[model samples]
Target: MTPTPKRTIVALAIAATLALAGCAPAAGGNAGNDSGGGETPTAGGTLTYGRLASASDLDLHTQITANNAFAIDKIFETLVSFDEHGKIIDWLADSHEISADGLTYTFTLRDGLKYSDGSDVKAADVKFSLERNLAKAGPLTLTAPIANIATDDAARTVVITLDEPYTPFLSELTSFASGVMPTDFGGKTEEDYLKAPIGTGPFAVSAWDPAGDLNYVKNEHYWQDGKPLLDGLDYVFVADDNQLLQRLNAGQIDAIEQVPAANAESVDGGSATTLLNSDSWAIEQIFFNTQKPEFADKNVRRAIAQTLDLPGIAKATTFGTARAASALIPPAIEYSAADAHDEKPVLAHDVAAAKQELAKSGYPDGFTATMLIPSGNSARAQIAQIVQESLAEIGITVEIESIDLASFRERFKAFDYDFMINSGQSDAPDPNGLVTFQADPEGFSNSYWTHYTNPEVTKLMHEGRTTPDGPEREKIYLEIQQILAGDVPYIPVYYSPNLHGTTAKVHGLESLPNGSVRFQDAWLDAK
Candidate 1:
């Protein structure tokens, strides 16, 4: 088993995706001609969603993927939440304050809050949840900067003490992993709790079909004044986008997640459908297992990074909307320095340099390596093909090994591949969120592959995490980005936008930058 600290680091590294809160559409009744043809519409309707893969687990802690996160976000409540505009606002907690040093955080609980089980939500539950994460409760455990947790029942307040000042701590608290679970429930294992999850969100699981769909109903007794506009939610596993589009056109489902870029325009062009565009907190990149023999050579890594055409890949994969990225940290973060940012350099078709680097690295003859990719993701497949063709020019052969979501995750976790196209959604708006991969030996869940252990980089990251924000902190962060750029542990790729397609009948769905959705203010208008 990985050490507790390393596991926590891995947990943080798995997702850097931001949330999109309260994202709204451009017009109303966008779903094909909203004609009230003498039919009375029901007040409550089921919102069916399409997902390529079924969730591995129902527990919010293990719900790391976008689809699972979307489903879990509806059922679980975070202490703090980002509004549609990406502003931090209270949700479970009425208010919160950070100490001057930024190591201590205090939160005041909201009154009348109760778990789905009808138990009062207290400060002790908050303390228990944070401690559970630090205790390595599951894959979502992220104890970065968190040293200890304490609560004062009499004062109705909770206090969190960190080992050091971390700027992104507050943002991270709003993550799905840190979502508080009920205290009274005792379970023997993770499997027991996941089968039937319970939380304080505005929705609760009414029924489930493990192989197909899960149903959730509104929490009428919710603490918030008004909530869960719809009567119930039905999550169906529709693997095909066309089928999803057809269903939505037929008024079967309210909204759908992950409308493929290939069909974004078509969906928008539909009379009743609208394409809702928002910034995805996710960043797509090609990661190399630095521990592997084929990737140990920095020359090889740099050569590959210098030869591929990122713009071409973005164009081919994301329908020309994505910007080719050069930096590891996405542009959303505040601490990222402009000079250190990767400028999406044009390697063009540099066969000569690629060959030369291969020669220098003692690989005079071509070598073969396996590339892992997610099954059914057309964009990943296209990029993999482009990379394969580009590498072939330099006497390198890549055998593509594509697998379903389950196999893909297990294989990647086992470090069984040489190269892979890994997507990241950063939780915090800092470069340190990226460092969790390199924090410890196999730092985060995603770090098992990077086996690139460097005392200097580690020391610098440690310093950057605790150091005060100033010229010194900026200089350290910029230096780290520069070093990682040159080292090429992962080849930075294009930043893709989060695209969604929904029926225009739905109103008040604000698109958030963090790529998270909220149904709080959503309402349907009968035409």
Candidate 2:
């Protein structure tokens, strides 16, 4: 069993995604007409979204993928949220304040707040939700700085005191995981809540017939007035890429995301569609089973990293929709490392140097290892074949194993696979998320894939998270990237653009730097 249940069974490593709060369209590509019909968003319509895969869980604290997170976001409202402008503002809160020292934060609930169950949303509920999530959630690390939570009913204000200053506290609170739950959330187990979730967002889970579809209805008690423009969302589960696209084309599904990297070209069949493409924070990598004694050496990981060709893989996999990822954060992150496009760094594509490193690692004759990948994905199969051919050049014989998604999940979480080309989206824009995934072996849920452990990485990630935004934080992450480059726990492959296909009728969908999509105001045009 995987140590962390929060990662979920449906968490796919192949998604071209980056995640945080809110979403913005990517800069490159055609950036097609995604702004639905110029008509004002109407109040009545059911937008049936064709998802790439089914959501295993809906509990925000446990939801791991962008699909689950985005769906859950519709049903759960956080104390804070980002506007379309990408600025964090009080969502459930009428107003909030932070002490000058940054150790104290206080917020007052918005007026006339009522959960779908008719229970009042109060300061106490915020405290309960925060306390519960901090104790048992994948996002615990982000909220670890909070020392205590206190609520004053008379003032209708909740105050949170942090053990230390956290500059990104507001940004972190805007996440789907920070969604406020009812005070009486009587779920003793995760399954308890998964069966029945209660939240105060724009929508509520109406019905979930596992094999058929999941439906969400309008939350009449939603605090926001006339928002979430649509009446409800009908998310249909479709696993096959071609079937999903066909459904969207035939109007069986209003919209669909995760357009397969390979099938992206097929969608442009002269249809009047809105193709939304965005720069993603996802980093595809060929991970090493560092838990194994044979891969315990950094030199060995570096050798494999140096042997592969990232640009060639990106070109073939994305069909010119992506750029080779030199850093973990993609071009969407226009802040610090966005400019640090380490184009073809040293030792990159150097077969001879990779062989030398392999020899130095006491494997002069190279080695033989099992490379596992999901069976149904042609893109992954192609990538696996390419990596195999490249490694063969250095005398490393890789035995490719194409397994189903279920078995692959088990093998990945168990650190049971020897070599695998896996991928994942970052949870946020700051280096904190990826750094956590890369550095700590047991702290973060995503760490299951990369069993990376280094005291320097741990320390640097801490500083990077806690440090105020400026040259210092940037310098810290830059140094951390250097460390990752040297250690090569996971080789950076390429950053692909996340795509969404829909008829010109669907509008008001946006993306964030982190690879997440929010349809808060998404509505379908009436033909």
* Predicted structure with the largest lDDT when compared to the true one: 2
Model 1 stretches with alpha carbons more than 4 Å out: 1-43, 145-148, 186-193, 240-252, 337-349, 438-442, 446-448, 510-514
lDDT to native, each model: 0.65, 0.68
Alpha carbon lDDT at 300, candidate 2: 82
State candidate 2's TM-score: 0.87
Instruction: Report how far residue 77 has shifted in candidate 1, in Å.
Output: 1.7
Return the lDDT, model 1, position 328. Answer: 62
Q: What's model 1's overall lDDT?
A: 0.65
User: Mind giving the per-residue lDDT tens digits that candidate 1 earns over 1-527?
Assistant: 12235222311111113221211211211122222343333345555555555444566654465667767777777777665444556777777766665667788777777776676777787777776666654545664667778887667788888786564566667677777776544343656666767778767888877656778887776776655566776677776556776787776787776677777777778888777776654678898887677798888887888779876788778886676776666666545433245444323336687777777775667689888998777778888999999888887899998887678878777877798997766553445655654334545553536666666677777676556556776677677766777777787687767677778676545555456566544556545
| Residue 223 local lDDT, model 2 | 73
lDDT of 2 at 491: 77
Cα lDDT for residue 270, model 2?
33
lDDT of 2 at 411: 85
